[model samples]
Every structure is written in C-alpha cells, then in structure tokens.
Target: MGLEADDSSSPGETVMVVMDANRSRGNVHAIEWALRHVARRGHTVLVLGLLCEIGKRASCFPFHMGEKLERLGEGEVDPTELEEEIARKRDEYKSCLQPFYRHCKKNEVKLESKIAAGLCPRKVTVDEAQSCNTCWIILDSHLKKDKTYIYAHVCCNLALVKGKDVVTLMPSKVILQKSSLKHRRVDDALLSNEPITDDQEEKSITPPPKTCCWYPLAWRTGFPRYFTQSELEVITSGFSEENIVQTQDNVKVYQGQFQETPVLVNCFSQNDERFWSMLRILSRVRHRNILNIVGYCFTGSSMFLLFDFPFMGTLEINLQNDDLAEKILWKARWYIAVEIGACLRYLHEQCVDGLIVHLSVCSSNVIYPLGGSAMLANFMTAKCLKDGSPGDNQSLTHCLNLQEDDGIAIDVHDYGIFLLELITGRSARCSLDPDKEDLIDWALPAIEKGSLSEVRDPRLTDTTDDRLIHHMAQAALLCLQDLNRRISMSEVLAVVRGHEIARPGC
Candidate 1:
C-alpha cells in the first residue's frame, strides 16, 4: 500500500523524501513515485536521512537494523565523537543512494542529500524540510507510524509511502480444482450437434494441447554453452557489415562481444556438412596454439561457430604490411613456427581416437594474438581420419596421394609452405608461376645455393640471428619434398625446433 500525493505538486518543484538508506529497492520505488506523481523534468529530489542513536527509541526504526549508532547533539556526547559519527553516517547514506544518482541524471532531474544524526526523528525531519524550503515531504513506509505526528507538527503537505516489501510479491502456489464426479465438458455447439451419453458425462475434461519452445539440444563434452540462431542474431547485430572482421571467398566472419568477452562468429550461408564436421572437430580439440571454439549455434538452413576474437588478425597480414611486420621480430617469427608446428603435431599424432588432419593450414588461417604465440585456425576442411585411414580424399588428390598417411602428408606439405611464408613475406598459393619461378621455385633454388638473402623477408632486420632463418629454411625445404619422401609431423617439429638439425635438400 502507498499514500496519496498532494494535488499541489508541479513540474520543476523540489521534492523532499525520507527513506531507509540501506533498503535500496524501497528507497528507489519511493523516489520513483515522487518523480511520476509529483515532480518532473528539471525538478530536484532532496533526500533526507535520519541516523538515530542506539536506544530503546531507535529500535523502532524499520530499516538498517544491527548497525552501530552513537548519541548525537546530546549533553553527554563528546564533540569530536559527534563530528566523526556524522561524517561516517553521511558517507554510508551517500553510497546507498548511488542507484538513484543514475536514475535521477537520466530523467533531467537534480538530486540532493542531507544526512544528520538526532534523537527525535520527527523533529529533525520537519526542521530540515523547513530550512531547505521544501514544502512537499514524502515519507517512507518505515516512518508510516510517525506520519500522523509529522503531519501535525510540519506545515508542509505530506505523503507516507507504504512500499510493498519484495518478499510480499513472491509467486503464490497454484491450486488445482477437482472435477465433479458426474460432470463433463459440454460446449454449446457440440452439445446441439451430437447427443451425449452417461459414460461421457462421467469422464473429466480433456487437457489442452501442449506446445514446445524449440531450441537446439544435444549431449556434448569439452564444449561451451550452445546458443540458438536467435541469440547469435543479437550477438552479431543481425550480421551487419559493420561487425564483420574479415570476409574470404565472400563468406564473412563477424566480430561480436558476448558477456564482455570479444568473440568471432563464422557464418555459413547453408547448413553445410563441413560446418558440422568443423564443429565436431573443434569441440573435442584443445591446445594453447589453436583457436578453440567459444561456442556454436545451429539453424535449419545456417550455422555459426564462435571463437575468441583474434586481436592481431592473420600472420599473413602482419608479414605483408612492412609497418606492422617490424612487430614480429626474429624471436617472434621462430616462436610462430614452433607453436604452429606443435599444434599440427598434436593433431596428426597425439589424438586419442586417431590422427586428425587440418587440411587447410595456411598463413591466412594462423591467428597471432597480441604478445602471445601463433594459433592454428580455419578447420572447415579438417577430418578425423580414424585409425589413420582416409575418408573422402577426392579434393585432396591434386596435392597428395590417396595413401594411408596421405592425409597427414597433405597437412605436412602445407605446413612447409607455411614455413616458407614465415621466412619470406609471401602468400601461400600452391600453383606454380609459368612466367618465372614462383615463391617456392625461387626460394628452393636460393636455399640450395646458400644465398639465404634471396628468400629472406626484406622487412626483417639484417642484424637478426641468421641461424634461426637457416634452420627454418631447412625444415621448409624438407617439407617441400615429393609426397613419397615426405617426413612425419614429429620429424618436421624436430627440424623447426633445431633439435634434428635438418640439412637443405639439393
């Protein structure tokens, strides 16, 4: 229950309200009433706080119980103690009133606070209202019993706010009514159309048809919360162009924020089988050097996979831009090779089920988070070759032989091309140039001649450690071998890490 407002309250007027500082919900509701029923834009809400001393009289206060209080403005009270108590109590009231500050600011209304400790709550409230020239004083429900006393002593118009405690509004239990022993549902239209029998009358009314609020459901492990298509729409802001981070082959990757954590959402135009395969692979895989899935979404005709938003985009972008390339020092470049190689090694050899091949490993698929090592990404073509046997290798035949280990060979070969791009700032394209030597053709001949400068990225400092580049070039040349002579990922990892000391092939 709440009290009535005075008819005299007008726009731009000052409103004086008394409420328990600790009960934030009730105080806000009481102020909301003042804003709506009395004050408007440009008005001022002057909140009055009364900190009563600890006594039998103070126990009557309906809010902020169990707090320490000291006698104020008393004959026996020390002056220093009174000042400290008043200052401390004012700060307490200030903090409790924080919720109102934002609400009042948005409404174009000014809010003020006045906190004082006293023995008589009624006398102190009336004196402050008069001194501030506030004629309409609003009382909290805590002071409902004192409303009569306030109304008589104070000359201003008064209203006692009887706010409903939150607990009082808890949902009540539902009760079911028993059907009559000889009753049945008899619609007027159906009763006139067909005659009813005694047996039918004895039956109870049939329940209404049930409905389902549809969403995707599945049992999964090593995955985050599964989102519906609708949730993804809100996350990506309806998949707007402004949220797009990158678009390849006209397929856009959107960047969005979820729960204050930035995420990248990959969209598919159709419910492609590749999307599910990627989802299944990403859900089970975890590594420091891999861009793991944050969550995923499913729909009738589309799908989405969410990952941690890459801060530094692709390794290709960093190497291609000379201004940004400087950030990737000799140490970072070596770090990138080792980290990506470890990720590939983990996928090719260390899986519990079988070797998983990331067939799409490339510079554009490598994400380099700021200050962190490189990460492997773009698993739309990844396959779980259980028992090291080939599944569908139709698309992989051009670059690999369809052997038991051919799928692993394909990834190893691409990883070599990845290493080449790491040393020489060039893109990873498998096709050779007929006009002249392509990046691979030009670099392979240069490495054999010991002319390392011909293939080194010009953006790198000349004073950098040449030993690092020498080892990387050797690993790349070994990886570029013919399919029959290709080495396993473990050997490739060893060569790049300078553990096996691979020699450049003639």
Candidate 2:
C-alpha cells in the first residue's frame, strides 16, 4: 500500500501526517495514533519523515577543511567517498520506514513515505502538503508557534497531535485542587455496616482547609510575565553591585538567576517608552542569531528586561582577550561572519510583518554564546516598517542623519566595518598611528590595491587562507561604498559565500 508517486484517487480524501525522524518514542506513538485515525476514516495517509542534519542543509556553507580536520585530523575528501556517504543516507532512510510500512500493510491501509532534507523543514513540508489534494495535515504538537503558523495558512485543515502525558497535565486542575490526599490515613476512610459508636465519632479528626493561590492570565498564555518588584529584588539580590556586569547612563545590566535559570536583567531608569517599544519588537522576533528575551517588568518609573545570558560574553570582549583570540580558529571566524550577515538579512527581509532596521550593528552588540556561531543583541534602537505601509526611507535617513540609501544600507555599512575588524584581528577603533584611527579608511585603500597581506592581522598570518582573506577584504570594501553604491546584506552574504561578486552599480 506504499505509493511512491502521485495518487489520482478521486474517491477518497488525503491525510498528511508529518513527523520528525529525530523525535522521541512518545512522538512516534502519537504519529501512529494519527495514522490510525485517518485510515479508520477510509482516507489515504502520507507520512513525511523530516531528516534534520545539523549544519548540513543546502544553504549551509560547507566547511570541508573543518570537517576533515575533525575526523581525520587533516585530510582531503575523496569524491567516491562522498558519493558513498550520500547513498548510505538514502538506504538508512528506507530502513527507518520499514516499521511504518509493515503497520500499513497489516491494517490494510494505503500509506506513502517521503523523506525531506532542507534548511527550512517547515517550508518543505508546506510544499509537500500543497502538491496533492490534501484535506488535512496532522502534525506533532511539539512544534514552536512560529514554525506552526505557516501550516495553518497553507493547509485546508491542520490538527496537532499531542502525547497522552502532555494532554493530561492540566495546569488549571493542579492549581485549583482543594484537598490533599496525603493528609488522610487509610483507616480513616473505611466504612462498616455496623452502627458507629460515640467514642469513634469523637476520635475522628477533621481535615485541614485548602488554600487557593491566584495566578495571572499572562502566566497561562506564554507571553512575558509581569514580574512584581519584590520578585525582581529577590532574583537580583536587591540589585547588588557585585551582580552588575555593565552600567551606563541611566541603565545597568546585572547577571541574575530567576527560577533557577541564568538571566541578564537590564534595569533602566529613563526612556521607559523606548524600553517598552524594544520589548515589543523582541517579543515578535524568534531566530537563532537573535538574543532570546525571557520576559520583562515595569514598575512605577523603573523598567527591567530579561534575556538569556550568553556564557561566553560579547564578541567585542573576546576580540580584546588575547587568550580567547588565539583560540578562535579561522573556520570559526568565517562562520561567525556568515551568521551575523544572516541575522541582518532576517531583520531586513525575512520578517513576516515587514522590514526591521537595527540602528546599531556594532561588534559590542554581537554576543558569543556556548556555540560556534555568534548572536546579535541590543535592539533598543531598532525600527520596523509595518506591512501595508509606505517605506520609511525618510525616517530612516533622518534617524541616521546620513545621505545613505536607506536604514538597511546603514546596517550594511556598519557590518562592513565589523568584517574589517574580524579580518584584521584589530578593533574598529584601533589605530596603527594617530591619524589612522578609523579601520575602514586605513584598510580600504590597501584592500582595493589587492594588498590583503598588508592589511591582515599578524596574529592570523600563520592560519589564514589567502583566497578567503582576499574575498573578505573585497566584501568589506564593497560594504564601505557610498550610500547609493553600497550593497545589501543579502548581496554581501552572496559575495561572502562565493556565489556572487561585488561590482559597483551592477
């Protein structure tokens, strides 16, 4: 009953059951239940298994040297070996579906198995769902809200199947329970046919009354919690000076623990409106390159925003630390550059609402977590253009007070400067002499003359690849162009990936 091709069955409806192959056993059982329900209704089921290989998507840049170095300690890949690996993956996917095939055969149900590999699995799933006359899509309930939003719009009907345990654990029921069963002894509940004596009735004890605790509606919805002043004080130890990691005019950032989770608390004493606006923007954005906002609090004239603290600190800090600088390999530096470019691309293009402009795209705002890539943070100055509205070209130009192409071009300019810093292993503010304080001015001419070695940092001389060094320098020069001539973040990414080249007015 396994159909590999399109089914022209006009008599029955089609049910698409999407599952992640990497999910736990419980999720597999949930998928089985969904399949049984659809089959019982005399409909055909299409089970799509998503193969999500970390850092192996089509859009991902292949780090051949890094992979080979990790596996063989330094070697080149053989073409035949790579082909064998791909064939092995295909065989493994087929083996994974053997149990599903057998189940469909035993139940006399028609089933089709498909394997999808891509950068965005949800996009692939949506494409598959639209390929046929699909009536309904049954997906796992463990998907994030942003991931599931598209499925609802693309499919005719979508049903989320949850595990039994998840469905049974009702938070309201647990919070509203009136009595505790632990308080009563087993013998106290026993009933006998014989009449009860006065002594037995007097000896019987009355159970203690139950207490009811109230929780806010926000707690149930998954929106940021409205934390009380007392709770904030307790978490940050009354905003102790020792806990403070950074302090600026009217603002202080403290490293604190909330509900046993490490969090960064930013206490602001001014510009409350701006803080709330930033919070709204952060709440709408969900991406790996962006910092995760846990929650926020507003009390009287003071405001606080919570974020998941990055253990390794900011990219600026790492660049300044000689010990850490030596550990950041050439491959890691290239990966970090690409990641920052991707973040800017998401803010400027991929957002569903409209475009977002990060007014500040400097290295100080780039945080390096416990991962190979970097994340962009500090969105206090970000601006967004809502859908269905005219472009904010004037506002963007006025904000930056520059004759740039737009707000996005300003980001490209800042990111270009960041790339220069990454390549030269020097701060953007670092100067070889008094007059050459600006890195862009000092390095642009050299990069234009193809003197990459002269501009590159001496620290990276031993490990740097000349080709990559040249490409990065060329991209940096492109980013430093005039307002109307600078390239977009997407174009910068394309050039960095070697898919495109930079040319003026192209």
> Which candidate gets the maximum lDDT versus the true structure?
1
Q: List TM-scores for all candidates, in order.
A: 0.51, 0.58
Per-residue alpha-carbon lDDT of candidate 1 for residues 124-192, written as tens digits (9 for 90 to 100): 676666565554677786765455445434445556555532110100001012123322221111122
- Single out the weakest 10-residue window by summed lDDT for candidate 1: 167-176
What's the TM for model 2? 0.58
lDDT of 2 by residue, 1-506 (tens): 11111122233666777766445332564456555544543467776655445332232111221123122222234435443443454465456556777777776666665544434566556666667776656666554332333332352445455553221111111322334444222112211112323112111111112222122111122435567878888879998999999997667999888655567889987445567557667766755577757678877678888876676788878878888887766655666677788788888877755578887887788886543347789987787655443433422222224332478888998888888877877776565467666787778888888787777766654644565565666678778865568467888877765567876566
Q: Candidate 2 at residue 306, lDDT?
A: 81
